[model samples]
Target: MQQIFDFKALVKYRDRAAQRLGTVTPVLEELTDRLLDRLDDTTSRFSTALDFGGRGVLAPMLKARGISVDSADFSALLAAKAGGTPLPLPGPADFKLTQARYDLIVAPLSLHGLDDLPGALIQFRRALKPEGLLLASLPVLGTLHELRLNLLETEETLTGKVSPRISPFPELRDCAGLLQRAGFTHPVADIEELEFLYANPLALLHELRDAGEGNALCARSRAIPPRALFPAALAAMPRKEGRMVARLRMAVLTGWAS
Candidate 1:
């Protein structure tokens, strides 16, 4: 893949909000359990661990297991607090990691945030041993379908635009193919759908912000969203009996180094 243009927003975004990073752990841990269950053996020579998107939660878990985990995050603040070394690049680094060299890497619900996903996958593949495993969970194409639909509806109603601020996530088949292309073997991918009920659209938005999750539109400026867009956006949401609902599709991929 061609190199991505230099862009660095998530670093500052995540750095100042490390505390909110733990909110997604319930969803991530669910996927993590499935990945671990599928592993051939937990006691195998997988002595070292790497948490690629590790900010607050996964880092602690790996440490508790007595494994030396090299935590990587865009947030320098998070890396410092978690006792991790920061990744040198914004999206993907071509160098190998020597901070306790990892045999298993866990990146949950974060791959879509990259600018050069294919290149990043290759980097992760190279960071592992021949028998090492990568347990990755990502928000795929169908993720947040309800939210996307709502955004489209709101766009049409308010601005006559039918698109959203966030990019569409990678399709499941495409993700598996990308992993294979990145040189992983026995690649397996699966999906788990999560439905969250909210009292209102504002509540849902608050939750997302509180969790430090937001649109990753790289080209968008730092200006605040217009006030008029708020209500229209909320009105476009899926409401049943005065309650709004959102669906999150989480995809998990497991592969071994070739």
Candidate 2:
């Protein structure tokens, strides 16, 4: 399969950022909290849980809830930060999940980067015990739409062509289908749209960088974008209350391992 993302580079970038900043993305943290809240409402008690690609957020929360939690991530630095076992989980093709190891598996803001999402979902299903729960939060298709549009229009106006500047995310219905394809029962996918205000477009870009959410597409432009591109894009962005606004639509998916 063709590699769509520079997964290793992503891991290295995230690790370095974590080492330097020691901060979590605000939106991601919020999303994780929401997912955990849903888990809390569940009547089923999970004895063993896997915080898959959660960057350590879910594990400690699960532990606090008296569930035995283990975490896995592609970035060793992130894993260490989360106090988890380091696992180089680049994609579904590299998955080596042990059968029926977890009663609950949760992945927060991680599945959108996978090259083989369906395969990953299948692996999650296989790794879970019967009636086990699977929950995942992924950026939906409309995430960063404004940024994508502004960048594309700016590039097209300047260079007469556009380059890939954002990662393509899955749609909500597609996520539901993936869960069903993975043989999970009672699949559910819901969207949560979040709007954030930034001082300027540069701030928004910086936030994405700080969150380790840079462009990782194989087809992404290697050359630096023109200096005027950003300013122009910023000027073009819609302002609300004197601040630039960015929107992110996150898809939360849940299912039961049958």
Candidate 3:
């Protein structure tokens, strides 16, 4: 996709980081708790679940709830590192979905990485049973708007090339529409905006790298030549209250089979 920046290596990097972190952030942990809180425990037969971005955090929760979860990821590295089923992204949902035979599916910050997000959602819907539930949390539109704006301004003024260094996340409306278009019933979506204060751009970049949220769009160029453009672009960004604030927008989406 045109919006993808350094897609291949970036995904690989994320997989590695996931292996290292082995724990979910407070934000994601909270989201997972909410999703789990909404789970219907009336049916003990439907105890099998699937974790799409399961780096290892939700495993304990699912186990505690007596639910067996099949953790999956497109990254062979992540899957192997995390020691679970390794699956391809957005292909052959029937095969994987059947293999797992899950009644609940959870994807935390995983859907946005797909190039064909709409198609992937369709696959997720197909993977579910009539009474199955699908839950996903992804960064949507308005995410990192400040960083994007600053990068654009910097590129325009320095290199005259606005290299979008981030993935194109879908908006909350688009995400809900995608669930419906993919044939999900009772689709619900909520937008959550998080503002993180950074000491500077370098610090922000470091956090992004550690979080594995750095650029991964394949269409993007990853070359950085040693020239005045680099410094000039960095200088173009503005400081806010003596610090830089980057705003991130994430959407929590849930749906059920019809």
Candidate 4:
């Protein structure tokens, strides 16, 4: 697959966050809760599951339902923190899984950073037992738009050069199409718009780093940016009720393994 995100960087950031972050990011916790809630709508009882990218939220929930779960993440520490044996990512876009092994696979707010998202989806589908369920969510097009725009404008004003700061995310309309392309049955996709608030722009940045959601685009420059860049850019975001607001357009996706 063509390069997109730096997978190793992603792992490092996640592991660091696992070591240092004291609490869960509200957005992550909310998304995890929302994804698990989808399980309630399904009549089929799942016996086994894979908790991909859960931040100490999903494994407990699935176990509570008496479903045995295996947790996997690029970061081993992250998987351990999620309360399951760590299944590490073998490569940027490739991993081996036993075919027809799981009753359910829940990959929330993950997969978007992958260089080969379609390939990863196909693997997830292949790992499911017959009629198994795949429920996932990812940051779609409007996510982080406020911060992205402000950063771009800030960089342009100071350096007169454009840089790829924010990673590209999938679009909502095409999410279902992705599932179809990966050969999933009964594919469906929908959007959930969420808003979060922070005290200031720096607080927003801090939360992002603490959540291990820092920029991992392969095209991102390694050189240190202007000292004033972040301060100026984040300060420019529009505030609501005296708090800086961040919007997340999440594409909640579902499919069945045939």
* Alpha carbon deviation, residue 84, candidate 2 (Å): 3.3
lDDT of 2 at 3: 85
Q: By TM-score, is 1 or 2 better?
A: 2
Pick by TM-score: 3 or 4, better one: 4
Best by lDDT: 4
lDDT of 1 by residue, 97-199 (tens): 5522578888866677667787777888887887788888878887667666766676566656543455568887787888898899988888877777677
Please say which candidate is ahead in lDDT: 1 or 4. Answer: 4
Whole-model Cα lDDT per candidate? 0.67, 0.80, 0.66, 0.85
TM-scores for candidates 1 onward, in order: 0.83, 0.93, 0.80, 0.96
Best by TM-score: 4
Off by over 4 Å in 1: 1-6, 22-45, 83-96, 161-163, 221-224, 239-242
lDDT of 4 by residue, 2-60 (tens): 78888889888888888755655555767788877888888899999998888777777
lDDT tens digits, residues 98-120, model 2? 89999999898877777888888
> Which 10-residue window of candidate 1 scores lowest in summed lDDT?
1-10
Q: What are the RMSD figures for all models against the true structure?
A: 3.3, 1.8, 3.7, 1.3
Structural RMSD, model 3: 3.7
In Å, residue 244's CA in model 1 sits off its true spot by: 1.8
What is the TM-score (0 to 1) of candidate 1?
0.83
Alpha-carbon shift of residue 5 in model 3 (angstroms)? 6.5
Give lDDT for model 2.
Answer: 0.80
